[model samples]
Target: MKEKLIQRYSASERINHWIVAVCFVLLAVSGLAFFYPAFFWLTGIFGTPQLARILHPFIGVVMFLGFFIQFFRYWHHNILNREDVKWMKSVKEVLKGNEVGDIGRYNGGQKGMFWVMTLCLLALIGSGIIAWRPYFAIHFPIPVIRIALLVHSASAVALIASIIVHVYAALWVKGTIRAMVEGVVTHAWAKKHHPKWYREMTSKK
Candidate 1:
């Protein structure tokens, strides 16, 4: 018999995720090129250095808007609760390949990552607008623009680090990537990793 599967993400949700992810990669490369002379060669990824400089802020805007939509769609599922506390406390065991707590649609770490990404995107957008030149930057004082640049850079670094963890966790946890890619998971995967969610899904049938 074929394995039973449960839907985890809709097609649009998966498309939105990949859009944000691609924009992030492009922005990271261009931003790094502009930030460090040693990595100036990275700008070639966008055709030319001048073009990269021009496209970086625009890509940042796209990424921010994409994530903004995602924030609203999944925020409710990511809310922290007693179960999250239990999950966090037993994170070590979870890392050892044991499921912990009555895991819901998301675990403690996933919830925390969601919020962290939200804050970083917020910071990135706000700072990015302030530092955008030939436009908003001229309206702000030099010192203010400098501070905004600092915040933008810091937020970018934090976001990059958090995304690395997110990617790693997706790869480390069996069947996790399928949720975003194919938009479904085997029943066994759902039951083993997210028993509470599994019950909720099954009960609805």
Candidate 2:
């Protein structure tokens, strides 16, 4: 039998997602190496410590730009609503292999993660510029630079933690990874997890 599929993402969207994902992993590893004495060995990811230091900020800019594209593209569908609130309250059922609420293209949890990613990215990029090398930091005073460093570190930690959860959830939910990789989801998968969205899609066809 032919497998029924529904489009979940486009080629361009998947490409942009991967660009951000790759840059994020690179940045996370290098950033950790720079932040911790023990993890300094991770500098091998970008060649040497000096190389990692130089490339980390540049990679960060790339990741930020890539995610900015994703942000505008899907932010509308990600808006939270009453259904999202109901989904949140019934999250236990969701974790137990059941889905609740009139879920749309994104679930409540996904929507929350979207906003978290946005805020973290905004903070990281803004503070990163203030603490950046001889180019931008020199424009700011020592105290200001110190604060920016702290803000940058805090936001980095938040983003890293959130991404860890994001990856884990994707793995835990079968077909979730396929949506991002193949830009499609099986009709059954969509119907089961996002019945309202499934109905909308089917109704349009």
Candidate 3:
């Protein structure tokens, strides 16, 4: 028999997600290159240091907009509840291939990550505008611009770390990547990891 599958992400959602993801990678590489002398070579990703400097902020805007759409669409699902609290408390058990609480559309870790990413993006975009030279930077005092750069750097670091964990979790979970790539998940995978969400999806049919 063919493996049963359930849709997790729609085609539009997958496209939107990839847009943010690709832009994030470009911005992270360019930002790191600008921030650290050791990683300056990373600027080559955008062709030249000057090019990277020019493109990073533009790409950041694009990424922020893309994620903004994602935020509104999924924020409801990520809202922390009693069950999420229970899941967080039993994170050890979750890592041990067991889930705690009635897992919904997202697990506790994923929900936490979503909020972190949301805040980080907000900070990044605000600070980026203040520090963006020849554009918004000219409107700010030098000290204010300096402060914005600091905030932007801090937020970028936090976002990068969050993405690392996000990527690791996606890879570690047996069928998680398929939910994004193929826009579906195996029935068994859903039943094991998110039985509540699985039931909700199936009940409509």
Candidate 4:
């Protein structure tokens, strides 16, 4: 039987999600422009190299703040349980597409992504503050500023990689994007992809 689930995401939640997504895309492109000379052409999209340099840090800060809101909203649900640890141990079964029945609300991969992104954001924010030119760096020691530069670059790389995996997972799971876009999943989708969550939601009423 097909059943409609009540809205899981409010209008505010959807707005926040898209805000973060757009900022992320901008940050990724601008960051890449500065990261590689070969990708220098990308800066033209934002105007010039000088403008890209000026805007990158500001864009990064906005994206990180947006991500912080999402992290808080979903952190409770994404917590790792014993089942998640077992799912990680049996990840091979997941790769073979045979462990759908055993997966929980998030599964191990999603939990791992959540944690990794959290750590990366912390690193980026900290390093960015220390390395902020024309502001914070003027008071800090040069050595500290240099270290912060390295940390910022490393964290950005990790975050970009993590987001790539995040995007891939969303696309890999059918109906996943629709859940985010429309803010609701069908009962069949909930039951098939997150049986425990489905049962809990249904049992509540």
| CA lDDT for candidate 1 | 0.95
Question: What local lDDT does model 1 show for residue 13?
Answer: 99
TM-score of model 1 relative to the true fold? 0.98
lDDT of 1 at 105: 94
- Candidate 1 runs further than 4 Å off: none
Q: What would the TM-scores of all predictions be?
A: 0.98, 0.98, 0.98, 0.91
User: How many steric overlaps are in each model, in order?
Assistant: 0, 0, 0, 0
Across 1-205, the per-residue lDDT of candidate 4 in tens digits comes to 5668644677788888898888778778887887789988898867888888788789878878888999999998888888788778887877776554445567788889989989988998898888888877898999999999899889889989889998998888777887778888788777776778888878889
Q: Candidate 1's residue-wise lDDT over 1-205, tens digit each?
A: 9889999999999999999999999988888899899999999999999999888999999999999999999999999999899989999999998988998999999999999999999999999999999888999999999999999999999999999999999999989999999999999999999999999999999
Cα-based lDDT at residue 122, candidate 3? 94
lDDT of each: 0.95, 0.94, 0.95, 0.82
| Predicted candidate 3 versus true structure: per-residue lDDT over 1-205, tens digit per residue | 9999999999999999999999999999999999999999999999999999999999999999999999999999998888889999999999998888988889899999999999999999999999998899999999999999999999999999999999999999999999999999999999888889999999989
Screening candidate 2 with a backbone cut-off below 3 angstroms (N, C-alpha, C), the clashing residue pairs are none
Error of 2 at 141 (Å): 0.6
Query: Which ten residues in a row are the worst by lDDT in model 4?
Result: 96-105
